[model samples]
Target: MAELLKAGAVFFVGFLALYLLIVLVVWLGQERMIFQGHVLPQHYAFSFKADFEEYSIPAADGAILNALLFRSDSSSRGVVLYLHGNRGNLSRWGHMHRPFTQRGYDVLLIDYRGYGKSTGKPTESGLYQDGEAALQWLLQYYEARKIIIYGRSLGSGVAAYLAARNPHQLLILETPYDALTNVIQHQALLPLPGCIFRHHFPTYRYLPAAEGPIYILAGSHDRLIPLYLSKRLQPLIGTPENFKVIQGAGHRNLAAFQAYHFELDRLLLP
Candidate 1:
């Protein structure tokens, strides 16, 4: 009986140690996992077909944020301040702005810190500052009512943060989560304490105070950020009806679907 008890205690201790090690590793490396930015050379020239003017916006903390201002072929209606996902630089994401630019709205896409030519490392707070700097730069030429804030995936939190603090024409979040904590917990193998995460986006907290029309787009088959997680954010919007679902679309492929364009047309086009 004594031997059996000792063996059981040893096995429990070993399992506990392994679990703690996993937690420590995850906690230490969560930033890399969350912000998967692709760095670019300082002098890398962008070769997009669209008419774009690139600029290096200055962040409050001395970070240089690289951005592209894509001018519309037709007369400008407004500008979409597009905050992109956690992966890739503006070169990869610039092509995704056709939906807005082709429809006569100029698109401004900024690379988060450590992404593209943007200097400094990325942090949740740093991204918010980067977004504010972008908006301030835009305000020099365009009125607040002419700026539409759009967030995608990881950028959703940044968009929400910006919208909550600034006045804009509209706020759009694609494949967003209620909170970063909720997303981390949902994707974890085993249940994890919320304290383990350093960045808690808390879009739900920002969405309530955001000015202007708030619209959320969700892909029916988004495995990265599931439909239900996006649905959880519907109640935060003043008009929950603005919550749009693109059927047959997944996280990254929503732009390929006709339904995605249809929804954008309904919301954006004259």
Candidate 2:
């Protein structure tokens, strides 16, 4: 009996130490988990186009952020401030603006501080500053009502943060998680205490104060973030009717489907 108790105590101590170690790892590397920016060298000249104008918006921390203003030839409905996901730079993401620009809505796609031709590192608070700076830069060229904020994946958090603070024509979020806290907890394989995270992009908290029509687009089969997370956020913005589920769509391939365009029409057109 004594031997069994000793073994049990040793096992308990080992498990406890391992659990604490995991918590420590989460604390040290949470930023990497949240942000996956593909950085570019400073002053990297973006390719010029006939209709596009590249920008180097200044941030509070002296970071030169990279962005592009994709112009629409037809009568402009508004400009979409396109905030992309956690991964990749504007070079790859620029292709996505066609869905908006082809429909006469210009696109303003920007990279987070470290991504694309932008300089400086990425932080949650700093991203909010970058987002605001982008919005202010856009407002300089167009009226406040002519700007529509669109965020997908990680960018949705930044978009929600911006829309909550600024006035815009509309706020469209695609495949957005409820909060960074929720995302960490949901993705945690074990029942770990992921609630004490540092990077809290509280989209649910921001949506309440946002001044625009909030259109939430979620995928029916998104494994990275479940569809119900988007459903949960709908009540915070408006009725469940505002939550539009694009069938057969996942997190990354949402733009590849025609249903994605259909929903954009619902928000962009009357």
Candidate 3:
């Protein structure tokens, strides 16, 4: 009996040590989990130039978020609220600015919390809050124009949640995962209990509620999120007609795809 109790104690200690180690690693790698690396300053050298304005909008949670507003010289029919991927800031999105501007659509690129010069640490809830704040800012400023929410990678979850609640807006999701739990399960290779993670974005739960003109874009060679995940979301998202899969494109090289630019132009053009 004493030997059995001793063995149990030893097992308990081992389990506790492992749990603590995992917690430490997760805490240390939180920023790394979201942003890939430090975002360098970007200079837009595109042939077409748009009038750019920098703005800082206050979030509902009192965090100040930075954004770049690009307005075309021509008539503006609508605004594109661009929520970028996990890593990098609005500067990384400068490359795509010309396409939208050339199409006569205003582009608003935002930096979520802990991204670029935005304040506060990045949490899943915080990113959602940032998305809401950005949408609200546009509604206040561009009340007459149509608002389109464009999300890429991690931002897809944020855009999904917003679209679910407010169906009047247009939603364009690029290389999005089914849910936060799905991403953690597949990418982190952790067990099912990892669903208890505090930062779970849970986009899958919100898909059924989305009632808008939805557009889905995925890459055939996207190994990170995988093509199957996006394909799985098709039925759940009200059978979207704008689903597109770009050939020869991976997770990181989405910008290299001519199809990406073509789709954006086609979508923005009236």
Candidate 4:
């Protein structure tokens, strides 16, 4: 019986060691999992069919952030400062400007640090600073009332952060979460300490401080950021009319849904 007890103690120690190792690995690799930015060459030329002018905004940290401003063909209603997700550069996301530009709203989409032509590494605070720089640049041409802040997936946190501090015409979030920790915890293989996460983009914490109407759209079938996670944000800034759910839609395919376009038309059209 003493031998069996000793063996059990050894097993427990081994298991604990393995668990700690896994936690360490996850902690170290959190940035890669969170910010999957695609880097572009400095000399890379963007060729889009849309009427767009490129921009090079200087960040506070001496990083040069690259952006694309797609102008509306018709009379401009306002401008949309679109903060994209964690994947790919402006080349992959630039096509999305059509939805806004077609509706007479010029779209200004900027890449975060180390994404596309931008310089330096990306952090939660760094992303916020990049967003602030973009907002200031947009304000140079348009008033705060004519600016709409649109955030998608990973960008939702930054959008909420900016909206909380600055004045904007509207705040639109797609596939947002209450916080970045909520997303990691929901998808984690083993329960992780919040400290393991380097970036905690607490959209819930920022939403209450936001001025004006906030609209949150989520796909019912979004496995990446499940509807429940997005639903957690509704109570922060949602009315029955503000929080929208697109049925049978997944995380990446909301634009394919007519219901999504209907909502956009209602919100964007004059």
Which candidate comes out best when scored by lDDT? Answer: 4
lDDT of 1 by residue, 144-242 (tens): 999999999999999999999999999999999988777766776667766788998889899999988999999999988889989988998999899
Q: Higher-lDDT candidate among 2 and 3?
A: 2
Look at candidate 4 and tell me the lDDT of residue 181.
79
User: By TM-score, highest first, what's the ranking?
Assistant: 1, 4, 2, 3
TM-score list, all predictions: 0.94, 0.90, 0.82, 0.94
Q: What's model 4's lDDT at 116?
A: 94
- Candidate 3, clashing residue pairs? none
Off by over 4 Å in 1: 1-15
What local lDDT does model 1 show for residue 38? 95
Q: Score each candidate by Cα lDDT.
A: 0.92, 0.85, 0.77, 0.93
In what order do the candidates fall by lDDT, top score first?
4, 1, 2, 3
lDDT per residue (tens digit) for residues 2-59 in model 4: 9999999999999889889878877998899899999999999998887789999998
lDDT of 2 by residue, 7-86 (tens): 99999999889878777777888888888877776656556343688878998778888888888888888899999998
Q: Tens digits of per-residue lDDT for model 3 on 110-209?
A: 8887777677678888898999999888888775238888888988999998888763457888898887556655765544465245677777787788
Model 2 score (lDDT): 0.85
Clashes of 3: 0
Measured with C-alpha atoms, the lDDT of residue 65 in candidate 4 is 95
Candidate 3 ranges with C-alpha deviation above 4 Å:
1-31, 35-50, 190-192
